[model samples]
Target: MVQGRIEKLRFIAEEMQIAFHLATNLTDPFFARTIARHILVRAENLIAHARGLRRPLRDAGFDTNAFHTAKEAYATEFEEYFKVARHKIGAHVQDFDFGKRIELWNDIEIVKLSYFVDGAREIYEGLAALTVPGYVPYAVPAELSDPKIVEILHQIQRSLDARTWVEMGTDSLAMARGNTSAVLNTTPVHARAGQLALIRRWIALQLELRGKLAAYPAIARLFKERIVTDIVSFCDCLVTRPVAADALQAMDGLNKLVQAENQSSAAIDDFVAASHFETDLAATRRVRDKIGAHLEIDEAETLPMLLADLNAFDLDKALAFYDRVAAAFNKQCFAVLFLRMYAADGARLYGVTMGHSAVKPFAGVAEPPPAAPPALPLINDEQEYAKNLRRWLDGDENQKGTARDFFWKAFMGSDSIEDIKETEHFGSGTRYHSHQFRKAHQFLLDALSDGLSDFDFKGVLDLVMSCRGGAPYPLSEVLVRCAPHAPVFRQYLICHVLGEIGSEPHESVSDFFDAQAHSPTWAVRLEAVMARYKSFIKNEGVFRTNHKGQTKVEHDALVASMTQAMSPDERLICLLGFASVHTGPLAGVFTTPFNSNYTALQAELEMLILPLLNDDDANSKVAMLKQLIQTHDYVGVSVHIAINLNSGENHPLYAALVDACCRGTIIAASNNQASRHLAISYVMKKDHRFAFEIAGPLADRNPDWIDAQILVAQILGEIVGAEADARKRVSSIRSAYKLSPMQEAALAAVETEVQNRVTRQEE
Candidate 1:
């Protein structure tokens, strides 16, 4: 028979913990969607578990009053939080639709449903309030040191108030290093690596909070407000008379450092060249004022603002360049501080060099740059492009132009479409120009009507790269028409246009990748791999759905036209797509099989992929394994490794899987943990030492999971001889973990064994 109600509560707590880990740890939005759905399912299961516990607790309890009161309050509070989420968010109905409900208060509504920790905490609080024996379970430990970590973080902030910049920077760096000392002593390399990762996270936060903040308003604003005035004054002083000492320092620090090409004449020249400094300080100011510091301005507000101002690349480049400038300046300040610390004889050096007033900007500094020259166009090339575009748009001529001819002309006169789209105003030429590009888009599609036999594939790729804007098309019609063209060219169009194929009947992007990989040309095979990658990024490579269910007939026809051998890269990409699209454990009763119409195709692809696991090329195999790890495919990879193990094949693949497990590098969620445990069980019969390495990290992470704790205890007893220290470790687990009737009995059996071993050893 199953255990009592307390056991059920513990099981619910375990699920809640796993859900919280997956939701918080996995940061990628595409991967988080599946994790979020799993959390909601676990939350629903918790409600059922809570309800079942009430009847059992009342019948066995003498303290029913407190239990009853807490239950009623919790139920009332839960209904308020979960009313819309239970029906509208979790279900697809006519009036209360998931999409419509999400649009109302998107992040606020979704987070309440997805975050299980808060709900779990409320349940724990009520259980603690009850007075019945064993009814009030142990409080769950905070996820990796809650209040203590917060306290440590506050201490670090207090330390940041050091007098000088160097002192503050040194203190922050020391705290970052000191945080990882305990992780280094954990005894296992894998566990140490996982724990030490927090140091990098701490450093990244400091860089964002300390580094970026110091650079933005202080150094950036100063340069913007004073650079032109300082430079003009220095030039005027040089012509009319001699410069003052403060002016000389200002010119040496700001002007000479920025405009100097005499690399041998100064220390700053070498620093500037190595850092890739951009000389234009005025452009940097525009980006900061328009985008970073202000809120109300727009491209419409500043239409005559240079088109280059709107491109994100230009701003990003300018920001990066300014960061280097600030770092160089900050370094000079640190040097002065270091001199003052130890060199008593060099007090004069500090006094002369520490004149900060010269570098700092004043309120009166102001000037503007001279007017820029007008833009000129390639007249003949533009005329030809215009004629071809007009002809193709009007359907006036039977003569067709190549994508290369049209795209090359566009490139000479303009930047990438991304730059143009960002730079120009919607009311100005930007809107009209984007409309014209949409016409050019249709013209290119019409050019391919005759098929890709005469198409320069590279040229078409260049054109595809240039054609960017928010212009809608009938993508279903385009896909159907493009399907019969040359395999290479058709795959490129599919890769580029997959975003527009929403709810449209089309071939699976996977099928095209599998077919094109067999082509004689290497370029075609590379394009095929890239196309599958693009499709995976768009929506996990699932076939699109319509209101009338899947357009199954259209997809089947497209898959049936394939004939090619799969390259290694194609196999790797396809496996990644399959694993990402299919989640959950593979070992349980309700495991889902690969859902697809092409059974024979999938079987053939699997046959090709299995050999890769055993390849002699270590680099290639590791590369493939990295891709699997990145796509959250631990279960799928484990299943394949198990199949190979049964057949006594692929020794290298087995070694790789064991290394990954022992290193604790895989996603440490419930399904992934289950898969790793299963794999370790099979490996345990051969080598107990490797099994021990895997067991410690698993047990450490999942201290609340009774099964995991028991498993780790058993592994320790078998491999490490159940010494005094080992037995003590198991005893600690007994106290910390909430053991049920079954778990209590099982643990008692192990404890008896350990006691017998201790007596025999003493004798």
Candidate 2:
């Protein structure tokens, strides 16, 4: 029964955390899908362990502490796994962890109870194992495997609630680094090297035999071989004077290919003669005619068509085919003593394109040697390329005739795409013309101020980069796509990302970043903020009023947007954002954005918020408490809390703090940004207190709740402050968390007075 209950408890926890992300509006579905899958895997480990231990605790002399330690480790693993899971989920653990969160909005008392429940379970198991009937609870699993079990693992699910767990995931470190405790083993040196020199040498030698064939054409001509005669016949057939219909078609295609070459052929022919071969166009014509009849070459189509197909080789598809061919070669070569596996890769690409592989040695049919490789093409003269460039920039859609001509024109014209693909292009027609992003974006942007939608990321990106003139455009439209990391486009994309996340365009762009000004990455996160550093200082005084032109609804909308951005890494940025809320005057720095509240004391709030909430009655304490409550509205009496923490008495969230103590209700009655008032009521006996919650993307913001809690505690403490004999009084009212001697003494004194007063009243 206990085992089943524990299993059920695990399910509830896992699902609860998933639900919490929606509350902050930072739920990233991609991350959620990934984390949920991993949770299932880890849960299986716990189920496996439970299966191994059967017959319950009563049947064995079990050491429960050992199991408890393992379980504790398991819980730690859950927290660790959540570190990565949270990152994967697109938030940070600090933003979602329930333990930390409960401390913020709820109370530490609740987490304290959680600690108690965990401790009680451990103790009960050990004691029960030692003294009475038996059953041991399993580890707090970080993963859940079974679909049905996912519905039961509450702790495992809640384990992921830590906000950072969704953003920066914790790796499931092996209980220890891989096998350090085990004996060492090693492998062969050849395994480490990836390649064998002997294999390279063997392949090269086989190519050498083929390379020796380079003298074949000259030898055939010298001998007046059949190859020479066949070549003449083929040339004659192709050059027939009347220009047969097929011949006419061939001439036209040849004209286009040469035209497309745009005088590059002179350079190509010159390089070929100098680098790899000796050209004899008259002998070449004779050899070429005979080549068709001497060897079985495919000539069912015109020569240009065949050559074009050969040049447009698709390497990826070739490799795929080659894989199968390679396997076949090994199988064929295996039985031979000398296994020289044939690979046509290099020869098919750069060699003389002579591919006739016959296993049998030539008897009387011995072939002449092969010619050298084709001369690589190069554009030697910049001015010469101008002809093609003119054709490309001026050609009408109709004047572009022939596939080769169209392809050449389009390619040489594009600037950016041409750069990425390098100067060389197969043909102008290969690229998609209608998909031009520049024109598409101009059309879309003209139609809507927000820019295009329904386009993918690449499309939007291309349009932004191709803008005609220098100007800034709002990036909110693309924010949903290039989230978290700002898109890279001369840093303009960064501004868009910031604006999108910020959700409001400030009177000046500086205000947008200054808004998150408290983020850990604040001031540094967006360079634009620092860019306007001087300007901000100059106009600092008018900031509140500058942005004041925004309607209250708009201002509130902006604040909500800031909160959503901060929610993901609440711990990472909340302090930074809160601290920067009024972070103008910046103490002694050049005071451009002069903050009226800028005093050394307010600056010290950074130091105060990090430490205990109620610690300092120092100079800055008053500045911290200043905006917590405004008496004009009548809290009847006011309380305060910092948005920074749930502890500080001067917290900006005083309203929530007051509300938490009362009917536990917090109502932000007004939606107006400037005149907004949070009404709160905290009553103890016949007395009640009230306060308001001030909110914004303010750094280390003092939420009213944090101050409210501390305020109520102070009011409780002060009412009992006058008790006498403070130190030596209380020897009672003690249970846990050993109250110091002074607290005991003080409490004893207060208790005595209260009792005495009640007695007198009774008389």
Candidate 3:
């Protein structure tokens, strides 16, 4: 059912991207407005579908936590667009109030709309990848064969790729100058790979923009400048730096460092004219900053206001500008590429001409590479095996039997551990597919069986360790049955398999791990502890799936063994595993009478885990504490801490709670500042001790966090009563600080009440 929803969402999301493309790119205002309205409606629909898809995705055993967060953020930004573009003007309303006039929004706003569409597409694609076959490209279905459109698309991609180089090139140029500008400024090959990815995405968007629509010259001009600005920013990253302004110091410094730098041909100033670079970059920056969608235009003005200046967007002049800018960009790409080649060749400095020759093609218009002949014959055993596997998986059900038979025979025929490892099998189509090839447990067992006589224990162990999805039968039973007969492989299995053991159905299996818990090897013992905790969680309510048939008595025995022998760190894992089963964005989703039985156990586990915080390794503790605070039981946890503070039974781990609260408060504030403020108020009402602990940390940070301060003040007034001295301090604090009108209004009301109390006292 979830897969069906995800598939439906992907289809809708793909159509939305197409609508957005038509909306933004069409030169005809009437058609563009029509398409834009369609996009807005589609966006609203897509959001509703995405929200619906979330729960199903989570229940389908996919983690939707991070995806949901990203979706919410995208939805929020899209909502504002929906309000303005659709609700107010585009589709729903033809008229508006006198105060507001509907002017077509700038191209910059259109770009942002495109980003939202891409964001939605990304989420849908990611979900699809989890359950679909092969690469599902987010291809924008459009016809864009015009030369003008193709040229513009390439230009956009080249500029986007160049933007990545800017930051890296700037850093390299600075370091080069430090080394007297002689050193090659090589970046990692990974950086190039990353840049290529950006280029592909940019290509996708630009192609989408070239849908069957007339190009608007004004919008195109603006887009060109945006691209140029990005390219300039890359150049600027190299040139922009802190420098001494005083002439004497500048000259003196130049003599000391500049002279040495001038001896080398790699100096940035030698490659480009500083004055020209500065002029072009500054011009582009001004247009991007002042004219783009990020900044608001005056109410009376529109985008065409800039075109009133005759030379502002002259097509002829832009062409000339492009040539000069493109050349400079090419030179920069060459210089950076040369540095990389130089480094790779053991710092063999090719002369300056060699750098120019090599980098020239990157700067020019890139031509498509020649297409290779299709259907190359399989060249190796690995290639042949992979080909046959994919063909079988993709072929008919009847043909799949041939593939399965071939795979099994290959496994049985295998003699060495290496050959057994090389054996491939596709267990069933119901589970995994060509996109992700995970062999069945039976196939792995067969492969292991083939090599067991040759003492291929390592191969068996490797296969066991690779088990992410549990085996069809108990892995614990298989190990138990094999261990006594294969003593040579016992130690290897003992070390590796213990971590993979999710549940123990039998006493012998439980005893096997229980005895290993006391192993001399700390690593082996730690693995056993983790395996036991996993077993406990899976067998029990947490996850509520994948049961390991262990009775309460057996489960308690495992916990008892862990508590008696495992270290604090190991216990921390057990505590976290228990908490995670219950943790989520909302509480009470899985509430049953069974929860009451585990409440005491949960409390006891929290107590044991909390005190073990260390300055050296508090990352895990901090993370666990944050997760605990986010859980539905946060109110319970907070109340527990407040009770502890009230009784003056402050545990050493109380500081960790404070840290968790502070972090949670920051996240909560971003989502809802009122909720955070009210939380502070609630704690203050419970115990001033708890309230002050939270309020003190919040106060120490931003004074501008007036909501927090206002709540803190209100809480203080409740705690202290309306004393004259307290009123004076509040008045003094209000006057001393700068406050926004809203803050002042809130403070004024609080002060006026205090003044009233003071007057009554005087009367």
- Which lDDT value does model 2 have at 116? 28
For lDDT, candidate 1 versus 3, the one ahead is 3
Q: Judged by TM-score, which candidate is best?
A: 3
**What ranking emerges by TM-score with the best candidate at the front?**
3, 1, 2
Residue 84, candidate 2: C-alpha displacement in angstroms: 22
Query: What's every prediction's RMSD, in angstroms?
Result: 32.4, 37.5, 28.8
Taking the tens digit of each residue's C-alpha lDDT, what string does model 3 give over 162-226?
32111122222122111111322223322222222222222223334433223644334333433
Worst 10 residues of 2 by lDDT: 165-174
Candidate 1's C-alpha runs over 4 A off are 1-543, 546-563, 567-580, 584-704, 710-731, 734-763
Query: Which candidate ranks first by lDDT, i.e. highest?
Result: 3
Residue 475 displacement in candidate 1 (angstroms): 23
lDDT of 2 by residue, 620-660 (tens): 54444444322112121123333334544444344333432
Query: Candidate 3: worst 10 consecutive residues by lDDT?
Result: 351-360
User: If both were scored by lDDT, which would come out higher, candidate 1 or candidate 2?
Assistant: 1
Give candidate 2's TM-score.
0.18
Candidates in order have lDDT scores of 0.39, 0.29, 0.43
